[model samples]
Target: MLTFLLLRQLVQNAQSSSSSETVYLPLVTQPLIQSLPDAQQNHIQWMLDEAPYPALSAQAITVNLAEHEYLFLIGGGEQFNPQTGRLEQTSRVTRVELDENGQLGTWSDTGDLPHLPRRLHGFTATAVENMIFIIGGLNYPAGNSPIPRFNNKVYCAEVAENGTFDSWKARNQTWKINADTSYDYEESMAYHAAVFLNGRLYVMGGLRRGLYFSQSWDATRYVFSAEIDHSCEDLVWEQEETLPVPIRGHSAVAFERSDDKISEQAIYLFGGVTNDENDPTAVSYRANVGENGLEEWTPQAVIPGSAGIHAGTAVRSDEYLYYIAGTTQYDPKQNSARDNVYQTKILPDGDLQPWKALNALEYLYGHAAAVSTLGRLYVIGGAIVTNSTQMPLIQNTIYWTPLLFFSKESNPVGMVFPGEEIQYRFTIRSNNVRDLPGLVISDTLPTDLELVSAPNFFQNDRLLSSIRITLPINSKTWQTYTAVVTQPEIPVTINASTATATETVLPTNTSTLTAPATPTSTPPIRPTDDKTCVVSEVAPDSGTPRPKPTCTPTPVVTLSTTPTNTNTPTPTNTPTPTPTAMPTAVPEPVVVINVAELCFEGRCIWKSTAVTAPNRVYLPQIAK
Candidate 1:
């Protein structure tokens, strides 16, 4: 069963009402936690197991576009029998799109990889610009032969909105695979880690076939750099740089930012086994990429525990790298895995602050994770060994946790029909506590797209134009820009690209009611108990019939009058009824009551904090 926690800020306000009337208040909520920088706060909340991938995860890869919180799970294998321990790979590509609210929707199949329909495991897929390039990978099929074959080919796919992939094309390679080079299997190794930095796809450490046990070391230590040529026909590879040790099952992450319009690029390497092939390493390495090529190789921190392989499935945000589940210490006897998640803070000098243990992952080994620009990390697909039964199993699971201060989504993206004006809701958020200086937001459109109008705020401030617009820092309002297809005959798609930037490199309710009895107020009974409510969005009524979830339509409030007691008190003469100036009068006390009800799934699950005048008891009728 898939399990996850729904964590939200719980808030509500109770108001006082007169005894003769009833009051209803809408729910109110407030932000519970203050914002912090992405590096400082841990997005380690209990992760959500999104709708699981449609396929099993023996060795699937997940690609996440940081700007768009979209996740793609591609190519994994399923074991037929537990006894044989055989793997079967498929060429299927599954797309998991996170809704605008950051919740995972249903999984959709986004076609298949180009060329052969083979399973891709242990290869690096890097997103450069609008396309993702899938490099050399192994295609292990369950034939009679025990040997597995790897592909020397590299494929590219165009990334479309809403998790759709297209334009699958293979890149031309210089290596001509013939009978002569077929023996040297290192030319096409799988299980390698990759990072794309400044147009360069850096491929590192993987394994290749050799003369069985009699052969010498078989791990490929050389890191190959692949970049796109001007024509985009094929990939250009630079001279490979050998690592200090030959490794495989490692992870490579390209982490950098823009400074003064110049790019600052760095790729970090973490966790892999040596040439011997089974022993994992906890050590990490780093290097800087410049115009010349890879430079300044630095051996980084060693994780505290035993050497771990597959640590590359880490989700990185800024300097913090969170290594989710992997093999803690590979066991030759029984394939042991770990669920521990470790955090390594990258320092300026290629050193790491001590690795801190965070939330434990449910599954480990061969999973993929990516942190969005908004600081949410998505973890998907892997193999896990359950504690109840220590048997290895394939997974099709997905989870996400907050890892940064900016949990809010910024990009204004949507789909529109042809010739329809799409009013893009442009939003700029200041993640810093201090005001950001000189902020600029830009939206670029194709020649076929038309800009309809400018926002009033932008026009009033003289920041709107056909080009880029400047936005004031800490502005919470969402500015709208209307764009339509200039030529309706053109194919309908996202015709415009929207972006928000800063000219200066800056970092980055309630209901109420009621009358009080003469001066004496109930001091609004503040219910110390707070509860959270989860509501689903309702679709608009269309001709297409979709069954409503058997919910009894809530009747709009319409009712008969509530009868009140108007009884007269029995007249009695009291001796002590001191008649001052031959006249005496009696005052009547005012009565008041209040109630709050908690509803769920079309019914009131709970009700509490109903207060009444000291001697009177009022039972509230819970909403059905």
Candidate 2:
């Protein structure tokens, strides 16, 4: 039965497209193993041995070794033990290998964190090259002490090429207390976010629980940074700019933007609880990393339905930022675990577009999620709430799916006139760490538009409606096509066309992804030129030289007065001076054509000219 299920999954993956429903891997750990058949029990046991036990609030990171890529899952709160029927916390570390095709190998036990008697949770772990740094979190001591201890120590370890870790060494310099305060301001914090950017580790907002004086928890707005030394021994934390507001259980992700000449690195902060522990804020912020530290953060678009989100995981895949499952409410008795996944696009200017919903997951929170080098997203252990008892149930199930990055955009966003030729750029970006082969991009044009020229992939003169190209890892390839508007049939016609890119992988196939171009609309309006007009072409027999033209004026009328014959003319009385009829010399009809230049792909092309005659104006038929 296990073999059959695996075969079925492979078949489904091969035939799946991006628009189809998301396909999840089979559940690795099941809760009701004892009630199942013996064969089923054996299969469950086999999977459990290769997977981590049920836990929550763990931190995950992807490490790329010399030849293989591995995902490391660090400390988390093991909420339950079925054998003892008790709750537990763990300092255990596990890892899984990701194959070239983005398939996961069996999970292996790496080593447990040392030097601390208690297990930790709500901490952050970051990878700087081959070394991993474990930052502040809450430590749970053994035996009846229900209160969790806050920590300020920083731990560092080196990961070997075989995906094993060396002994973790504690840094000599730890988080320091503020000089003005009697107590530590943000030195000991948990449920915070940390990111490594440009050789520096940045720690953002988090919750600091009062240990000595009071048991109340307060959210902090502090930000700190440290320069990581080559030997990982002299790491020192330096305070940076604080956040606009205090927050906890948030997520932070940093990415480098090389779209322009001056490359920039940016950090984004997502949804979390504010000062009030139960109040989650949908507000997000973005800031650029500079030589000193982070610049002022600018508020971005608020995430929809994110007011209830906390303890979510945010990961960046290419140009997209994804926020995974998080708890909605602070109380354990409420249904706090959320299954929604929010996604947003990271613009070139380090701003974010509006957030949109993707496929939902199992109702869980405090899960660890990471993107493998092969462009696959993996969600590790989390906990779900029971409906009847409102108790939390820790889950060991692991789920993963492929991530696709592609976009289509039109150059002229606003108004497209009739007979106007515009350009459409289709960009395909590979988020994988290795090159992806056999990528087919298919574009469908609207009926009202005609394709003038497209990218020549085969070097042949013939035009192709679609293209097949290979995408280099962590890079983007774009192609532009010239299209002309044939008719302005409706008041506002949106050229909503889709382009699909299908990747063909061996052994395990990935899905085909589709991205539609931002709609280009053509509103009905009379074509008019705003600049000085020049005659581009003239009739053959007219013998008129091409020159800048002006609007012809109507012939002015004048009255001829007889001057001194004043007396004589007056005597004629007024025989209303018989006006002589003027003979009008008719000019030949000249067609005034307005020419505009359109450039694309470093080459300029002429747009169709509007022809106006002496007595009538009309749009000329553009030759194909």
Candidate 3:
């Protein structure tokens, strides 16, 4: 009965929603708590006994980049057997196909590793074209051997066109360092991070554990790089600059951006275990890949939510990087895993924006994650801690979710005046490995605005009533439409647009423009005192008004003659009248438009504010 209950609980947890609270904690020894109902106690006990453990320290990579790509899961500790009280690791290799509709097929075992005992874990795999490279890992000997050996060998295999891997072959040449000494430094490392870029293999920090109980484990900050020859036969390892701090159980990825003029590449390192084994560092770093080697490492935004996070997987899709589930916290008494997922946008200038959290999933750690060609994220085997005994149960399951990227923006986002033309730009980029087809973008302009011009691909209906277009994929398609604000009576107008792919889900975005009533000025009241003179004389040449002199009393003139008899004109003694200042016409107030970019979750839109206009309120349109 107990065994049956445990199995039932495992199945139920696996089928639960990704947002469900899957982490469990051990019970406390309190008398009041122990007095709780039996049903509640049984529920807690079920979570402890039934939750399936995750496959820890596995490596997953997508291969066979044809119409349908296959994701391969290789070498990890599968699960713990409660009866035997032992954790079981496997060397078996399995793969699943991703269909055209972005659906994953059932996982099937391909074959086991080509070595004695045929079991390994904590390895890193990189797929270059049709070839797959398996790096350093820990190998456990067959039978009841208590000690596991660290593997320094490199394995190569060719993935067949039909999504099957051929026979694996170990590289014969030893890693040559300085041509004077042939050393296998990688053999002493496991759980490190590795990435392949520009025909080079780069490996970062990992821990070296002693074979005996008396020897202490040491985490190293070493970094090494090897150039892959054209024939892919010979590789010479060269030591590069070490990391600022020694780390282990971290994840790394390579990003490359290219244009017509120049190409640049950089490597990013995520969270890992540093000097303290129990507490993981959330700090990340980025370094440029130059001709000589990696440049100086610069720190980036820290991962949020949890500080002691390690054994997580990081994958890049387009300009975004995702960090999947990991052990959230660990201690001698209790260890907890979490389903938290975080992502960050990679800017063009090689800087990372702040980390943003995504929807949660089942608690997992020491798992492997990959992004498929269909633009879907897949999380493979990982372990989960039980609430009763804190034992880990390896989970042999897979979960995936669809991913899409869409953004809409407008030029001159701020307050638009009457009779002014506004340009709206719609951009759709595909993060999928292949190009997507039949992407339709549609927008409806407010009644107060008029459409000026749009791209040839767009079909404008009745002077900005409705504009729609079908865009191409894998590129930023810009659609420009000049919208003229015709009516100033309407204080604010919103233009909402939606992008929908053939078989994809997307959100709607809106751009708002507030055209406050054109500033009006009242004509300055002219001064009309009783002494004022009215000008009504008409000019003979043009039909224009001529001003006549104001009526004033004449004064008697007096003159004084000089001795030389020179007739010097006497200075005018008439009292100078104070000039009356004409009333200054009031100028129209200047309208200052304040444009701001507002983002919620991953979607962003343009928001405009008229600084001169007061007490005006505008709200964003929420997508259902």
Candidate 4:
């Protein structure tokens, strides 16, 4: 019979190919390949030879490990082509592998995922296991304005040694997580914060879609809210705690250590926007979401400069978290990128500290990425902020900054006490007047700190902005002391005309004291010199006024050469009296530049000294 003959041929082929390793199968039953026309086949072959394309424009970071190193699996987000008015659905997993030798390489395409594309989701590898779990993201339409398509389902996958990846079937409803009572649509948010904590994955702060539709603008309603959920292995989502603020495009990192592990460990959050709508004025927050769903936040701390969405961050260790690139701020009304890189540190007390203006990335309003590896922080691809107002384009770039640990070598130099007068000085040198600078310094005063004296500072919009102020600290109130300095550019030039002598104030308690200006014509005063300060006394409790500091010993400006001209008269020399009625004196500059070799979360971080103009040695100028 035909079957008998085929079986005999198959056995013969197997035995014949046994020595060769690759055995051939009989073609008697399997379907044969359907050949196409010559021209069609050529087109198909050309398509097959092309390189793989990415599925999403903006995607989150996820990792799968092999042989102790990491393999990044990034995918799923929204993509739009403004020129073509073309919007594409993005939902696929792409792998970039770190090979056995610790080199980065890409793997060939495997297969499509079980689900379609969605944005703002959570994915993580199982603890001590080779399994990966992905849950909840919004599935938007494939067009310019995609909204309302939210994916609440959860999925998992495992990869084998042979480079084959297959997703596991959806987990059954072993545990169901319901929506938070305070939030109507807890499961619907994109670009929210998700982290694997304590045996469960915790999610917080995302937008709520589907509340408004184009077809029913009249019936429109707003349900923007914050949520935290755990306790589900499948489709069932149980809501836990509600976030104190609504946020999106935020990043979270978990700190795990053995000591006081239960309550002491925390998940710190950075830069994000509020609610579903985009507003540049919106502020960001930092909080701790406990295992029991209890949320606690530090007293409000604003992101110092221009805050933006989708910024990148790297957790160098437990205490120091660095934020890099992102759109500076979203003015949806204008639809442009607010590109800027703002970096700040979070104190152990859970405060959402302001971004330090001194440190900024090169590109502005672009989606910057970051990661900490081998004791250093690596920033990866993101768009740069350029003619954002004209033509916004995606940027493929890479940059990095070292995590400088704080040290006692560069300890903070200035301090303020309650109900006390303090003077701080800041100086700027310039080779050209066109080089403009701006500065803002804030002090963390005790609760009862008083600003009896207004800020008296010099600001030349065309040249420089510098200040030295003296403030009265309230003795009854107490808090940490802090300040910030922002300049148009770092490493300002020191020209011959610039004076190196800056005001110096000793710690003192006083009523109305006038300080005589140091003589510039004399040799510069040394730091060791003990000098007297003039006084126009006014009792603290009495209602009386006094004359301000006067021009005693006149100061002179001396140029190198004297001109021999008849028409031009020699410039007169007069001692310029210090502006006594000037607003509050600028605090004397005693910036604590502490360099510490700290061990944070089992890694070393070096905090470098804060220099004049440029705070760090190699940092780029902050793009306004």
Candidate 5:
């Protein structure tokens, strides 16, 4: 015991000598408390510095209609007819899936929103739990109508089983403008930002246009929070509080963080417009979510150069919030919002850290932004804002980014030639701050290739067409496959044609179309010995001649030379001519020409002779 105490004292003295360094003592005994002197602890902390965060490059992507995991840009006016300057609104639902890696994908169209396909814009789609609540946007314009009717309709869509988007169904609002319940808030406003936090839907900052308002438009300041009723079927809203200043075209993001002990959540507001404001508004405000209720709004950090960005959208990550492209209102006439992406961390003091530029986007307005559960940010359709167009010319373009902390690489750059043996390596390295799960990578080889060698970690036989890999977070692994390429052979095409006699000629020729049992090299000729035209034919009593073929070999030929007295031809016997020349190349199906001479212009032209022996078909001579 005495020796152990002396050694401990020596260790403490050594640690004290080095005040700039932090030394962890050994855990030799239970409940052994070790404390560093206050001065030394301070000095050690002063020497330490926080590590820089690793960032990956983001990519702008196009969305596809049939793909899943896409953030849907519900309804907006993009099909603008430049000729009439008439703005057309569509109820079309556009969707885009976020890539796990920063890669581009195309946007696709899906089923339209049910019910009347009203032109919808200036609305907010807030995802709460598994449901996306779209609240408050412009429904109809003053197209041959008395005034513009803003839609206060509330709709909610549940995420499908595989995380694909589903159809939205209308949910009736039980809340009203006044206690009398005569006026409904859901039917009167548009261009509002809505967010779902703490099991309640918060709708704020929208424009209500009607004849009742003095200026025909009201930038609503009243904030409304809605919660499901006991049956979870109907929504009950309460006009809780109002904003310090009501602004339209602003974006709000709800961020959940840890306060060391309890979970902390807050919503940050950035950029909007008031009635009198000339440019896009840049006011930043924050509201804290507490156990009892939401705290009062407090001013937070804004984007560095401008007041705030309007039309640009914002999405939240685990520790940071990203502000995407919107109209930059530094100049009202040239409100060109450049393609820009900015990010800021949610600090412990409930304040956002200094804004930093992350990526850039094409300038646009009237677009939407959404975030998937896997930290993918999607920027939906908006117009490319140049100094030229009077209206925000809409684009059907979508961009997506997968903010991955780790990096993946595959080797063997280009073409893998047939019969060439090669090795392919897939390496993944983790530089992420946190651990991740469901990290799967799938690779499918060409059909002809065969895998000869693979790592044991890569499961399956050598001939597997596809291999999937799932990696743990913050770890590195490599997979290699050695394969031999095998190219497939292509079959040749042949010309096959039918032989037919002319119909106008009465078809009197002995026409025989039969494939021979044995292939012949030359055309068939009549058999002759000296002056005697000897005829050799199959005997009538012959039953099933030897060397039978798939088709009977019938040949017809006529004697061209005059028959001498010693070479008289017999009635039942005919000499066999050589078989018709066999086709050298493979035969392909071809069109048959009429095998008849033209007797029309007073000239009766003929073809060849008739009767021959086995396996030969002959043509009769033409009398011209």
Candidate 6:
């Protein structure tokens, strides 16, 4: 009996761990706090798990365009044990793909990397068109050999014609990987950072050596230095400003904005580990980092939630930068465990702030890679925490989120469909936004919507700031375009002064209902008709189908009585037909219209703000 019960328990456990089917986390009708317990709602968000290549972490990650997928150059080979499970280490490389449908592909091994495997390193794509740049990492030796290998090699490769990798070309000779030069402390650097900006790649803080013993403070003197030429290809080495403090296994982000038509600018550095990789509170900094040594590297703000490592990916959308994912300090003090996602935004003035939590990740990611297309940020696989030294199987997991903005400058896009005519009205409100009152509103419609009339312009001259414009649409089919409101740029190198122009359109539902009473100022209202009429595109079950109506249909009829002011017709007929005229009856037309679409600035849906009567139809018609 005891043996039978144990066997049954094993069977149940195996069933519970199956990944063949998805187990959904019960959704809250409204967003709720994670602490509040509802037994039905609790679930594990597992995006990636055991796969063929499980031991890879901290390898180079980049996108393969021809395949339209993401590839990870990981460390370690797969390890399997029937009793316990699979073990992943930091000695293998793996590739994760994202197809056109915005889904991640299965984990497949690319042929072995040209160089020996390593982990806890940093890599990023180059801005020189389409190339991937991989920097230094710690190489872990496999098998009976207890020797360790740390790589100072810098590799460069491009996505090529065939679907396979070209040879790994060396960009520069290897050098010591440390932190920004301004700090006095450093640790064994495993996970450092590198980013490409202004035609140069900037390397940030990370571990310089492995922490073998508990007393590692003396080992923290390594500072992260800037190296413009590690590849030996470019002999020019320039150091930007040092980071606020020494950080290892931390992430570096370089944000650029080119939409302003001005030169692109970058919002640099953020969170990572300091000298004590296992302790979070000990790794703190107190310096401000500006562009180059021209400005001091300062810690302006701390990331909001728990700090994490190997969890950073820098993504730029339009004008904002999002630093996402990583684990916190591995020890017990800072956190029970590091969460997988955090978000931060750069202010217009260029300052770093604390990170806020985003949606929970499926698993822990460190040393991951990312690429942005359209509006989604795609994060490839990294490592899940298994043990201190033991690397688990590299599970192929992909995670992402839509790029959303709450900025006042966020513009709604307009779209038109093929072969369809649509009229549009554009309105602007400047009641509260003083800086944007007089900005010009300009937009282009899709091919289907032809501009038949100039935009209707309105302004509250008394306010002196607010302005509005309306455009009549004649669109033919489905399409979309961006509606931009820009402050006129004046040529001014006069004082070297700069100001971010402000622009805002009013909330759609808040428009005023009142209009001026002048003949030219108000829209015409149709006269009301009280005649009994019933018309529908759908015919009644017992009635004959009626003729369809044209633009306007009138019912026709004859009256038995004649008014004194109106003409009276004489009676005539083989059977004396009365000719007294009453209101003329015109045949009302019945029209069948299909609502192919209803859209707003981007996507369309019915608005709850206003409602029209059911009696009204697109084409006017009289019912008999």
C-alpha lDDT values of all predictions:
0.51, 0.63, 0.59, 0.38, 0.50, 0.39
List ranges where model 2 is wrong by over 4 Å.
1-50, 81-87, 110-118, 175-187, 209-215, 278-280, 404-624
- Could you say which candidate leads in lDDT? 2
> Per-residue error at 530 for model 3, in Å?
99
Q: What is the Cα-based lDDT of residue 204 in candidate 4? A: 61
lDDT tens digits by residue: candidate 1, 74-176? 6666443445545566676665666433456666744442323457666666666656677777666566444557777777777665456555677666532
Q: What digit string (tens of lDDT, one per residue) describes model 4 on residues 70-95?
A: 44334432334556433344455554
Candidate 5 local lDDT, 524-623, one digit each (tens): 4655432423334433224323232244333545432433233333243344444444333332111111111111112221111111011221111111
Report the Cα lDDT for residue 163, model 5.
Answer: 45
Q: Which 10 successive residues of model 2 have the least lDDT summed?
A: 40-49
> In candidate 4, how many Å is residue 320 off?
1.9
Candidate 2 overall lDDT versus native: 0.63
- Expressed as tens digits, the lDDT of each residue in 459-551 for candidate 2 is 223223345556654455667777776754222312112222344333432444344333455344444444444455544224354344665
What is the model-wide C-alpha lDDT for candidate 1? 0.51
Q: Give the TM-score of candidate 1.
A: 0.56
Candidate 3 stretches greater than 4 Å from native: 1-54, 81-86, 109-117, 172-188, 209-215, 230-234, 278-280, 328-333, 388-390, 404-624
lDDT of residue 354 for candidate 3: 93
- Candidate 5 ranges beyond 4 A from true positions: 1-68, 81-86, 94-117, 141-146, 158-168, 174-186, 210-215, 229-232, 258-260, 279-281, 328-335, 389-392, 405-624
Instruction: Judging by TM-score, tell me the better candidate of 1 and 4.
Output: 1
Worst lDDT 10-window in candidate 4: 41-50
The alpha-carbon RMSD values of the candidates against the true structure, listed in the order shown, are: 23.4, 29.9, 28.8, 32.8, 28.1, 23.0
Residue 326 of candidate 2: its Cα lDDT? 86
Q: Cα lDDT for residue 194, model 4?
A: 59
TM-score of 5: 0.53
